[model samples]
Every structure is written in C-alpha cells, then in structure tokens.
Target: MPPPNERDPLLEISGLRTHFSTREGTVKAVDGASLTVPRATTVCVVGESGCGKSVTARSVLGLIDHPGKIVAGEIRWHRTDREPLDLAALSPTGPELRSIRGREIAMVFQEPMASLSPMYTVGDQLMEAIRLHKEVTKDEARSMALDLLRRVGIPRPEQRFGAYSFQLSGGMCQRIMIAIALACDPALLIADEPTTALDVTTQARIIDLLRDIQAETGMSMLFITHDLGVVAEIADEVVVMYLGTVVERGGVDEIFHDAKHPYTKALLGSIPRMGAGTRQRLTTIRGNVPHPSDRPSGCPFHPRCGDAVPGLCDVEEPPEVVFGPARSARCVLHAMERSVR
Candidate 1:
C-alpha cells in the first residue's frame, strides 16, 4: 500500500457519472464512481459484464460518444510538469483534451481489430500515433514504432511492422495495441479487458508484458476486467463493482484476505480451483445482474446477496465504511454496525 503522505495523485476520479440515452430509457452506465490512481500504481476494476467497468475507463479518456455524456463529477489529471486539469469539463473536440488523450493517457480496447484500421499497415498505424503526439519526422516515427513493437515483445518487429491486423494472431494484435498505446510514453494507460479473447497462454504472456512495461516505464494503469484471477495477478488495488456502483475497494491483500462485502466474498468463492477430491459444482450468485433501468432499490446487490439484511440493505443506500486507511466497502453490514456503535 502507498503511504498517505504521498502528495501527488496521477489521476483522481470523484462522483463520476456517465449516462446514455435510449428510446426505451436512460442507462446510468457509470453511476457516481470514485477512484484514485497513485503515480506508478496499478488499480484494477473488476465486475460482471455490463457493470460499467469499461464505461468508467472510457469516461476517463473523455471518449464517450453521442447519446452518452459525463453527467457529473471531476477527473483531475496531475501531470509531472503541468498544472492539474479537470478532464470531465474538457470539451471533447477541443485541442486541449485531444493533446492529452494519446500523449498523456492512452487506452487499449478489448478488440484490437475494432480499434485498429484494417486499411492501414501496422507500421503506418504505430507511426501515425507516434508522429501525431510528438514532433518527429516520418523516418524517426517509423524507427520509434519498430522499437515500441520490439519493446512489447513482438519478434522480428521490423518484419511484423509491415503486416496488417488480420495477418497477426489475437495475441500479436493485442501486443501491437499495447505498442501503440505506449508510443507516446503515456503517464497513465487504461486497458479494458486487454486479454479477454486470447488463449490462456497468450493471456499470461500479455499480463507479463504489461508488468514488465509498467516497471520499466513507471506508468500507472487502470486495468478493467471481470476475472478475479487477472486482478490477483496484476492489481495493487482492487475495486469491486455491482450494477454500476463500487461495492468495495481495497489493496490486494485486504480485498483477497479480508473481503468485507458479501458480493466480493461470493465472487472469490466462485473461482474454480484445482485438485479437489470431487468435482464440486462451482457456486454462483443467485440472480443475474439487474439491467440499468431496473436496478434494485437501495443497495444494487441486495437481491443477490446471500447475507443481506432485510430492512437496512433493501431500504437505504449504504455509506462507505472505512476499514483501514486505504480500505473501504459500501455495504449495510459495515455501515449499520458502525452506526449502532
């Protein structure tokens, strides 16, 4: 855990809300989420699909498209050399934010094919990203691009640079995505399910690559994934989400060893294990995650929580209960007990 005396935070998100409009109704994709990323620290946001993990990451980069907007809150970006900027208030089309999107804070999406243009060669895309953010000639950009590819562990990067997205495997494409994300030497990187589609071995390699790069570059990362195993592998801090709200958040040790939220415990229990005498059925939470328009009243997880108290959890939104200097949970079990004391 980082010391409390650390004065500078690379990224600070508070009460962030991203809402989307639809003919049926509005969807609160990200509802009042707050988090912080200390410089050079990795914080992982984990939740089931549709629980706003990706939306939160996208919102940080001000990448939400039409019909979706950051309705409230502040995203403070504190650069090493410049004054802090409020990202939430920045105009999407303005040059001020456009300058920071790739150069200061980069993002890697789930599907590289969707993010990478099929019409452009891999070298061209990487060179474009590098040249766009930095004052470099075409030849220098190409050389830097090749160096980034090699840094991401792509073999024979000079040869691979001429290849297209379709020519590379899923793992290779993800590496290329990482290379592009790192082209400008960003201070923070948002990786949204960066290894979801790859095979297990490839996923391991990607995770290792991220760790190595982070160590070498001193870059903070907000890694979004649903897999607890992945969180365990890469996270210094973990934020557990449910129905677009953060249920619990803490350091890796506090979360895995002393999980306070019932939802967190249930998620940990659901992980399949090896070497059990009998093949026990994996435990699962009873209900599906409610739709955005139909979220449960009070606590969003009340309907699915095995240990939910009848009146408290169902009637009132729980306050964040601080267990330690850096650990807290939003649950009635903690809130009510503290109130009664």
Candidate 2:
C-alpha cells in the first residue's frame, strides 16, 4: 500500500484568478491567490468579507455558479487515494468533479440555513451525501447518519433524524452541515466560517469538534474566517488576504507576532487586548475593502496603507518577498530590503 499523504500538501492553489462577469466588466474575486493546505494540518484563510477567501475555496471544488467562473490558474489536489489532479480544469458539474466533491473534498458552508433545504429532513440530507459516495443499503446509511449526528453533538440522533432543518436551532443546523461534510470522511475539508452564526459557546464547540475530527481522521482543512481569535486558535498556517489577493502568509505565530504586510499588521492591531479597558477602542483599518470594480492601480491596498510611499507604492505593485520557505509578504515595504540584497 502507498504511504499516507500526510507528508505532502493536500491542496495547492497557485495564481488562481476566479472572476465574475458583470454588465459593467469582469470582477476579479480571487486574483493571484496562492496558498497550500498541507495534509493533516489546518490552513486558515483570514480576511474581511469580499477579500475572496470564499471564492478561492469555491474554485477549489469547482462550485462557482453561473456568471462566476475560474478564469485562470491551477488548483492541484494531491489526493491520498489517487494520483494528483488539477481541479481547476475539471468541469463543474461533470461526473469526475462530482465524484471528488464530497468523497475526497467536503465543505461546510458559511450559512447553515442557506445551505440546508426545508423540503428534506436533515437525516435524509446527511444520508444522501453518504449514500452518494458509498454503496450502502438504506439501513446502513441511516445508521451511519445517526452515528454522525451523535459525533457532531446532535442530541437524540434518532429523534432529530426526521426533523426538518427549520426545526433545528442555528447551531444544531451547523452541526448537521458538519455531519454531512464528514459523512464521506473526506481527505480535505473546506470550512467557510462554519461558526459565524453561532453564539460564543457554540462557536468554541464547533472549533473543538473540527480539531478533534481532524486529529482523528488526519484530514487537511482550509478554514476561512475574519476572526483573528479563531485563526489563532485553529490555524497551523495563516493566509492573510486583502482585496482579491493574498498579501501575506506564514505560520500562525509568525502571522500574529511578526506580520510583514501592512494589511496584516492592521488586522492584528484590531484584535482587542486582554488587559485593555473595555471602553478603549480597537485599532481599525482606514478604509473598507475596495469594490471589485474599483480596484486601485499599483497596490490595491495602497489607498489605506499607512506605509505607502508617495510614488513607489501607488505607481508599481510590489513583488512577493520570500523571507523563508514558509513566510512571504506582498508589500512595497520589502522592496528596499530586496534591492539592498
């Protein structure tokens, strides 16, 4: 038998450009985004909404809807059970992609209510995912679904099996979504803010659940969120995105303690300190993430960056500076260092 893929990167996204065509023009949702999700590890993609983290995940699974499409770049999946595949090239609705979607790569969507259907019982929904990938009898699927519900902390699995999504609380529904994703025991899991809608306690539980499952199953995870606290808790590596591009990425400790990019520093500064006064205001970035159509020239973040040089930062985009194999930042601040070298 082949060795486990734990030593290899489970997913490699390179220079990915996912775009949506509007009447006005093409909106680049994920422009030149690159990151790696190592097998048996968690890579958290952290950024404010509209930074294109979600689109990058969606592009990985070929799940982008009409008008939205992966226009360029490669999403290479180094599968545990099969040869490597470039997922970006696969047809979105084709059997090849569909076969891999849930079986090899599962996703826990951002919104449980929006992802679940009121027309079907939650059990059936979970069972359908299981049955689709595995050739199991109805009874077997049901038993597995119940076990999954229990594993995800749903109470009285049998009782909740027949209940519609509408009947469950937000947290319960989120758990159901997780159960469905875990049904196939995917090699990689993309969780897009799975705890955003839950209360603080529930959110902590969900994070713990994902961590436990990953430890048990040895599955890689791509967790997306804007909450730096959650990122610090769950991430092995961190990718900081701004506008539609990845501005910085490194190990979690490096990101929090030695952030290189201006945007990353600003984000870190915004996190509330433990001993700070409750009335003290947190640091905030100067401006909102630019609308896709209004992307600024040179550095997309220059308009809001405090370190922006008068002509250099606003006139020419900075190249990505590699501090080490596991650390990089795309910011003009590194230009002088590179030149001095």
Candidate 3:
C-alpha cells in the first residue's frame, strides 16, 4: 500500500467504454470501467477469461485496432512536469500518443512470441526502441540495450543481445520483453498476463523480477491477469472484474480477507489451498461468463452468483457501496447491508 498523502494520480480512468463491432453484433468489451493508479503503486486487475481486463489496458494505451473503438471515456495521464492530458481523445496514430506509448507508458503483453519479431535480432529491436524514443546514437543505444537486458536479470546479456527471439526460452523472451518495455524508463507499466505461458517456476521468477523493478524505479504498474495467485503475489490493490465491469476493488488484504461481493467470494473459494485435506473435486464457479452480446439484464454476474438476492440482483444494478477508506464494491448485498446499517 502507498502512503495516504500521495499527491497526484499517474493515470485516472473514468467511464471507459470500448466496443468491438462484429458481423454478429457489437461486443461491449469494456463498459463504464474506471480506476486510478497512484504513483509508485501496483494495481492488479483479476478476472476470468473474456472479462475485459486486457481490453481496459489496451484502451488506456489507445492500442485497439480496426474493429474496436473507444465509445466514451476519459484517460488522464499526469507526467512528472507537464499538465495532465486526456489520452482517450488523442488520435490513435498521432505523433504525441506514439511518443508517450513506449516512453511514458509501456506494455508487456501475454505472448512474447507474438510481441517479439522473429526476424529481428534482440539487439536490433531493443536498440531501435531506444533510438526511436531518445536521441541516442547507435553505440549509446546498444550499450543501453545490454544494460537493460542485464537489469532484467538476463544471464550473459551481451551474448543474448545478438540472438534471435526464437533462440531464447519462453522465460528469457519474456524477460527481454520486460527489458524493452522498461528501456525508456516509462512512468506507468501495463503488464497483460505476462507470465501466462511460462511454467510455475518461471512465473515466480517473472513476478519477482517485476517486484524488484517496481521497488527500484518507484513506477506505477497495472498488472492484468486471470490468476488469483499472481494477484496475491504482486498487487497492492485488487480490482475484480466481470463482464466488463469492476464488481469489487480494495486493498489486497481487504479484498482477500473480507471480500464483499458474492462473485469475489466465489472466486476466492475456487482457489485450491494446501493442507485442506483431500477432496474428490475442487470448488468451481457455476456457469460460464456470458458472451458480451448476450449479457444478462441487470447484474452481469447474477446468473453465476450464488448469493445474489432475488429482486435486487436481477432487477436493478447495484450502486457502488463504500465500506472503508479505500474499499468499495458493486454488489446488491453490500448495498443493502450499508442501507440497513
């Protein structure tokens, strides 16, 4: 957790809506989402697959291509010296946004193979990224590239720099991606399921590397993943999303120890814990998340939520219920409890 006296937020998102137009129908990938990333804080967004975690991050970076568009939103970015700028309004391919994309705010995607170019040498790519953002000579960029590789804990970075992406293992490729993303010293880093394809041991190493880098740089990060274990490992705050909406958000301890939303409770209950005695099967949340085009009428989660009250959860959307100084949830149970209190 960060200190209460933190002055300004690095990124502020409000009423964000991102929709994708398909032949079938428009998919509301991100609907009215909002959150804040305080400077030097890590906010982990956890949800099931297709819950809009990645879409929200892409929307912030203006990375949505052809079929997708930002219907409405305000993404305000506050740099160290300059005034805050609304990123949502900027042109997708404009020079200003491009300048900020990798330099001010960078993203490390889920699949390293997809992100890294197979044809380009790692050194060429990293050096090009450095030279693109900063007015550094080729020699200076090369030095910086090797330095970043080493900083990300890549063994024998100098030797690895000249290697192709395919030559490195999954873990090494991911570390290279992280190194490239951090090459410009970005103020905000968005990691979208960075360790999804790696083994358990490799995943732990990546998580540790991120924590170490965050501590060293004091940069804000938005870690997006579906894994609860990853959230528990790296998040200062947790945002639980369902069908493009944030059902609950709070400090890590608060969300884990005293989750208010029924969906959140179900999610926590689903995680397998050690020493719980052998059981025939692990607990599972019933029903799949509805498709974006076929979302339920009222609460998006009502169909799968076991504790959803009859009338309130099915007929009307619940208001955000503020529980403590830094915790809130969008759940009818929480709303009714607060009203009764």
Candidate 4:
C-alpha cells in the first residue's frame, strides 16, 4: 500500500450507529458517532467501559453479530488509487469484506487469550494469518511469522512460536497478537485495548512497540482505550465518547489542555496525576455510565455534568459545535462558553 498522505481521511465513520436488539429494548452501543482517521495518524477513542469504544472498532471490521447490527451510518474506507469503499454497505460476511479485513485492515482485540485459539500454537496461528492474506508458501509464511514475532520483541520467538496462548504470559500473548495483526502489513490497525490486561511495564513496552511499528509502517490506527495516560502517549488526535456518542474530538494537546465537553473534562480530571495529594481522593465523574438500553435523552452525560443547563441539556440534544478547523464538540455549553470568550 502507498504510504498514507494528508490529502484525505483514511477512514471516515459518519453518523454510524451500532445497536443490539434485545428482548427488553434496543441497546444503542454506538449512537450516531462520527470521526475521521487521518492517514498515518493515531486516533484514540476513549471513554468509560460500555461507552461503545469496542463496538465502534468491531463495527469497522464488520464483526458485530447476533441481534446487534450497524443500524445506520457509513464507514468509508478510502483508497489511494480507487474509489472509497463503503464498508457499511458491504456484506458483513462476504468474500470481498473478508479480503479487505485481514489484508487491508487488521485488529488486535482486548483479550489476547480469548482472541487466540488454545488449540493452535502461536506459530501456527501467525503463519495462518500471513498465508490467509498473502500468496505465500508454508515456508515463506513461517519465515514471515517468525520475523513478525521478532519485530514485536518476543524474546526467543522461535521458542515461543510453538507455545499455545495458555502457555504464555499475558504480555507475551499480547505481543503475539500484535505480531499477528501486523503480519499482513495492513494499511489500518484497530487496537482495542491491546494493553489492558498487562502490567504497567508491559503496557509501556506495548505502547512503545506500537509507536515504533507505526513510525516504520506509516499505518493509520484507531486505538480504543479508557486510559488517558495511554491516549496522551500515543494519540495524534483524540475522540472522547460518552454513552455511545462522540462528545469531543481534537488534537491530543487540545483535548488534554482545553477540553470543552463536560464529560471530557470530568474524564480528564479523573485521571490520576503524579504528585496529586496522597490523602486526597482522586476526582471521579459522579455517576456511572448509563446502560445502553437505558440511555438518557438529550445530552447523555447531563445527569452528571456540573455545567449542564437543566432545561437545555436535559431536554434537547446538542448540535456539534465547530471550534476551529480541527476541533469540535457535541455540547451546547461549548457554543455559549465560546461566545463569551
């Protein structure tokens, strides 16, 4: 694939909605969420658990299943030489989609143990992934897999290659997952909390590995995580989600230093800072994320938002306010606050 340029977005998710049809009610996992993943840049989607970060990533890969569907929206996958493919319009399980999935796009899931098969050796799975997207002989695939394992910093890759997922530590398994995801040299990588279950050191290593890989490959990434520290470390852009919707999006620095959405501010405040008073309780966003089936109307976060205008935020949905060329927020208060400024 040609190296991603700044001319156009690599992936554009517009008004996307992924919902599950449960017996009780429809669970709006992703509610009209839209964001752009620019070429060769890292866009981190972050929120509390169940805010639809994973669902959005899964929807991009057409992995949403059973009673859950991409109810609305367009996932436009831009091509350098051809027309953009509307992933949302394609058959979720069709051959065309399958061809694009592993070859053009790849994903490293949250749980490495669960994502990897216990039945297959790490080498077996890795080689299979390589061979699936490339016309390679068994020896060639094996060589590529070994090379990837080494690239991902799996020590003694040859030794670990024959081991099963269950036989490896969580960090090792996650490294294996990254190796598998990179085997095909996909243009885009969707990493949904790839470091979630690892130790702090392992998490830092994983983050560094991903950054190095991105630098070498120039592949665009959509990283889903709840860790603001991770977001600050890796993101070129940040998309803050709450209750299945994107509340704010901007440059990493802009989001961190000048967050406009109440939800985003609350989330930033909740991140544990170095030298914060040992005895002082960490700031907490006052209420739990509403269940998908029970999402509040208007501003999904208004119930806990300190700056919420009762009559406005509680009664009417806010329109997205464009703060500048690259900054925007879906919050009524942003417009009012900006007008005052």
Candidate 5:
C-alpha cells in the first residue's frame, strides 16, 4: 500500500454540478459535489434516494444524457503511467472517453436486467468487451470470457455463456454483469448499488466477490449506495451526501461513531440495531428528500435537520469545516463550534 502523503488519488472530483433542463424547470441534481477515491481504497458515497449519488457516478463516467448536463467542476483522473485527464472536459461520445470508459474505468450498474441486453448472448457481450480493449484473437477472447465467468462464481460457465441475459436468474445476471465489468481489468470500478435488487444472501456473496477481486487486483473503487450497513462493511472512507451535496466525509469509524453533522447523525441512527429489543422501533428521518427543482435555500437539509439553528442554517450556506485530519462537515453548528475552539 502507498503511504498517505505520497499516494496520488486515482480520481478527484471537485465542485461537480450536474443539472437537468426539464420542461418544468431546471433540476439541480448534483450541485457542487466533491470527493476523492484514493488508490486501492474504497470510498462509499451514501445518501437517501434522489440525493444525486448515481448522478455523481454517471458524471464521473461522462454518462449523463440529454437534458442532464455536467455544468461545472473538475473530475481529474490520474491513471498509472499516464497524464492526468479531466473527465469533465471530455466529450461524452468521443473516442477518447469511449476508450477510457470500459478499458480504464468500469461501472457495475444497479440492475443487471436493465443494463444487460437481451438481444445478445452473454458470451458475445463478454467477449466483445474483452476484445474491444485488448489485442486478442476471437478464440482467446472466448477463453478469457469463460475464465471471468468462473471467477465470478457462475455455475456451468460453458452453458451459461450461450444463454441470453433474460434466461438467467437475477443473481446470475448480476454475476455476468460483474464479469463483464472486470473483463478489462480497469484501474477504477464504479459500483452504483450493485446489490440493490438481490436477496440478502446473494448480496453478501456479491460484496465478498468484489472485495476478493479488489484485494487481488489492487484497483480503487467508488461505491455508491443508500445502505449504511454496506458502507460499514466495505468502506475505508465515507462521503455523506444530501440534496446533491456532500454534508460529511471521513473514515467509516468517524462517520458512524462521531458524526458531527445532523444529517449524517440521523442517517446513522436510522439503521436498525441488532441486539435491541423487538419492541424498539427503527428511527427514521422526518421528511422525504426535497425535489431537486424545489430545493430549499441555504443548507438543503435544514428543514429536515433536527438540530438546525433558526437564523443561520436557513439563511446561509455553511462552509465546510475541518473537524480532524481528513474529516469534515458542512453544517453551521460544526462551523461555529470549530470557530469558538
């Protein structure tokens, strides 16, 4: 592992804003979001639905579509043995971005059923992915695809390779998706809720598979999810996002035990405790996440934050205050407390 001070981040996102130009109004999906994924480490982006977690990932991969555009900020990616490339400045459809997408950076989407094409057989899709980025013959590509299927723990690798995505079970399809994503051995993997629709047992297996692969390959991962349990299990560092902005960021232990922001605290509190009595109800946040077009002013979470101050939190956006080394929060209370000390 690289030393903290000397380690160059594999990906650094700064002040990223992705908005959609809708017929009703412009939706500010991701407003000034920033975070970093250090080399060979897992950085999990956690938030409730509609908090722009997926948008942030899509923006990083230049996958935002029509009506939605990444209007500002820098996504600087540093690949090994190459110059730093600003992903935000690259064309979404150009050859440069296409080459980088699957070859250098890969994404495992939320639903394999939706992401996989029923028109093509699994072998065709996997072999195409391998051949696109690698200089290999057709026979070699097929061999690599089968090897990947086996690596991801798919049963009957040869039989499954001939089947289309629709013919496979959800867990099987998800495994194939993982196999395809890992086919090229990319430096960075963006897993956007990869375990969302799977059963608990399958989810555990998939998470374990990813961990084993990361350990063996030494690739960095940017994991985006709403599950705190998943964050606790897999994350080296955590970024807490709300309303398209990061509210708190720190080590997993700090975010879970010493959360300084009300939003982060509430989120952690909402997780169900294991040994608590059956009579105890699980905690929940007060209200639903605000719509992007109808977002409140100042701190986007003030209306929902339990400890929000009257004058300050609703009127002014709080500057990010450093609480410790590599730990920070965007909240008026923390900022004021830090100033007094």
Candidate 6:
C-alpha cells in the first residue's frame, strides 16, 4: 500500500455517524462521512437535501440536538496555537466546545430572517455575538459590528446597524447573517446554503463577497449547497454526498470534468449546459433518495445508479477507492477499475 501523503488540514471528519432516535426507528443522518477542509480553502459539500450535508455541518459544531447524537467518528480540529482536538469525543454541552463555537468556528444558517431575531436591533445582535467571544466593551463591539456590516457589502452601515431584521430585504438580511458569523473572525466558517433563497444576481454578489473575504482573512470555509453551479464558482475542493456518505471528493476541476462515481456523474449531468439547444432538457438522476428509516441493504445509491451491477451493488456496500492524495469515491465501479489494475 502507498504511504499516506501529508495533509494541510484544518478540520478533518472521519467515519462520522450521527444518528437520530425516533418513535419508529433510528435515522442515520450522517454515516461514515469523511472530508478534509484544508487551510484557507473552500470545501463545498454538494448533495440533495437529505443527503446529510447539513447534518454533517451541524455535527462539526456539536449542534445535533437530543434524540440525535454522534454515535461514532472523530472530528479532528487542528489549531495552529494548540494541539489537535477530537470534537466528537468532547461533551456537546461542555464549556470547552461552547467557547470554541463562536470564537473559532462560526456558522451562517440558511434562513436569514429566522436566524436573526425580530426583537433586537441588528447592531445589538452583532455586538452581543462579538462581546460573547471577545472582551471588548459595548462601544468597541458596536464599532466592530459596523466594520463587519460594511465588509459584508451592506449599504450605509451606520443606518442599517440600528434597523431591525424585518426592515431589511432578504438579501440584506442574509448579508447580516454573514456579518454575524464573521464577528469573531472565526478560523472556520460553516455556511449552510446561504444563497438558497436569494435571487440569481444577489447570489452572485454574495458568492463574490465570500471569495474576497476568504482571500483577505485566510480563513477556511465549509460551504453547504445543493447547487452545482455555486460549487463551480466557489469550491477549491468538492465533496459529493449521497444518502449519508461521501460518494466522491476531489478538486473542483477533477469533479466537474473527470468524475469518478456514477452518482457524481449523474449530478454533473443534471447541470444545465449553456449553448445547447433551447429545448434541450437537463439530465436528472432517476429515483428518489431512499428514506432513512427504510435504508437500502447495500450501496445507498445503487437503486438510482444507472450503472449499478444488480447482484453486487445491491448486495454489498463498496469501500471508498482512493484515487489520489485527497480524492476518492464510494462506488463499486471504481472498485472494479482498481481491481482490473
């Protein structure tokens, strides 16, 4: 076997299994999902709604609520100033992780209005988050808040600071969410489908802003989205998920051009190509994502995979086949290709 190459990793999730207990049965929201976010790189987690992209992001923050817990895996957080931490082993309710939540790792939720409070002024909310992780006074916090709002491309930062979230447009509110997440200058930012509700033009601007911020701050980001178009625009690395597992992962160029797994190919094929005939229909994956409760026996995506070998793919799960240092896929097709060598 080849020796593993060195990694410039910030957050590394390995064999993560997050399960939710219900009256009916346990749902494995994230199972054996592994990916690495290197320093100053944007790793986009692309998959369908229930494919565990969001759940995996939540798991890193220790945000899985009661009845839902991380049963297994290691979330290794490598800090430059200190030794690496296995977050999965830490107590979710403990103060250590709480301190790390905003100070080092911050999250930008999907819905802006829902994430921000209606009662408090935008300034207060921003200042509160800043003060929580920082020792700055209220005035200092406000100054920082204004700077953040300005950095996020919000117009008239002074006026907008005192305004309520309800008063702002959807795009503006989303910008506020990004500012709040950036309050502490977190080393890692987890943006969970931040542009899902924005208009195309607004979405483009938000993406550009994020890209610029990353370049300036040198902070790594784990951006979750179902849109491959957004992925192409932002991702340095791409991790494709299916059901609850990472089906394929590699450089953005590798994933878009030289896809490995059939599921990844299906996903790439689904994108609307430009310059095609006006009536050209976009390709789509067949079959719906299987319910977590009635889990498939073998490969989670075998049912929908066009190239699945009936007897094998439907009977046994495939191991992740490594392609390069940081590229691989969990598909029998790759397994077959490797065995042929």
What are the Cα lDDT values of the candidates? 0.90, 0.91, 0.90, 0.91, 0.92, 0.91
TM-score (C-alpha) between model 5 and the true structure: 0.97
Error of 2 at 274 (Å): 0.3
Candidate 2 lDDT over 34-149, as tens digits, reads 99988899999999999999989889998898899888899999865678899999999899999998899999999999999999999999989999999999999999999999
TM-score of 4: 0.96
Window of ten residues with lowest summed lDDT in model 1: 1-10
lDDT minimum window of 10 residues, candidate 4: 1-10
TM-score of 2: 0.97
What local lDDT does model 1 show for residue 187? 89
Estimate TM-scores for all models. 0.96, 0.97, 0.96, 0.96, 0.97, 0.97
Segments in model 2 whose C-alpha atoms lie over 4 Å from true places: 1-5, 279-281
- Model 3 misplaced stretches (Cα beyond 4 Å): 1-7
Error of 3 at 298 (Å): 0.8
- Candidate 2 lowest-lDDT run of ten: 1-10
Please write out the lDDT profile of model 3 over residues 1-341, one tens digit for every residue: 33333536889988899999999999999998888888889999999998999999999889998899999989999876677899999998999999999999999999998899999999999999899999999999999999999999999988999999999999999999999999999989999999999999999999999999999998889999989988888999999999998888999999999988888888888888878877835668998989988889779999888787787789998788888765889877777776798
Model 3: what TM-score?
0.96
1-341 in candidate 6: lDDT tens per residue? Answer: 33222247999999999999999999999988999999888999998889999999999989998899999999999887678899999888899999999889999999999999999999999999999999999899999999999999999999999999999999999999999999889989999999999999999999999999999998999999999999999999999998889999999999999999888888888877899878888778888988777779889998888888989999988888998988998888778888998
- Which residue ranges in model 4 land beyond 4 Å of their true spot? 1-4, 279-281, 337-341
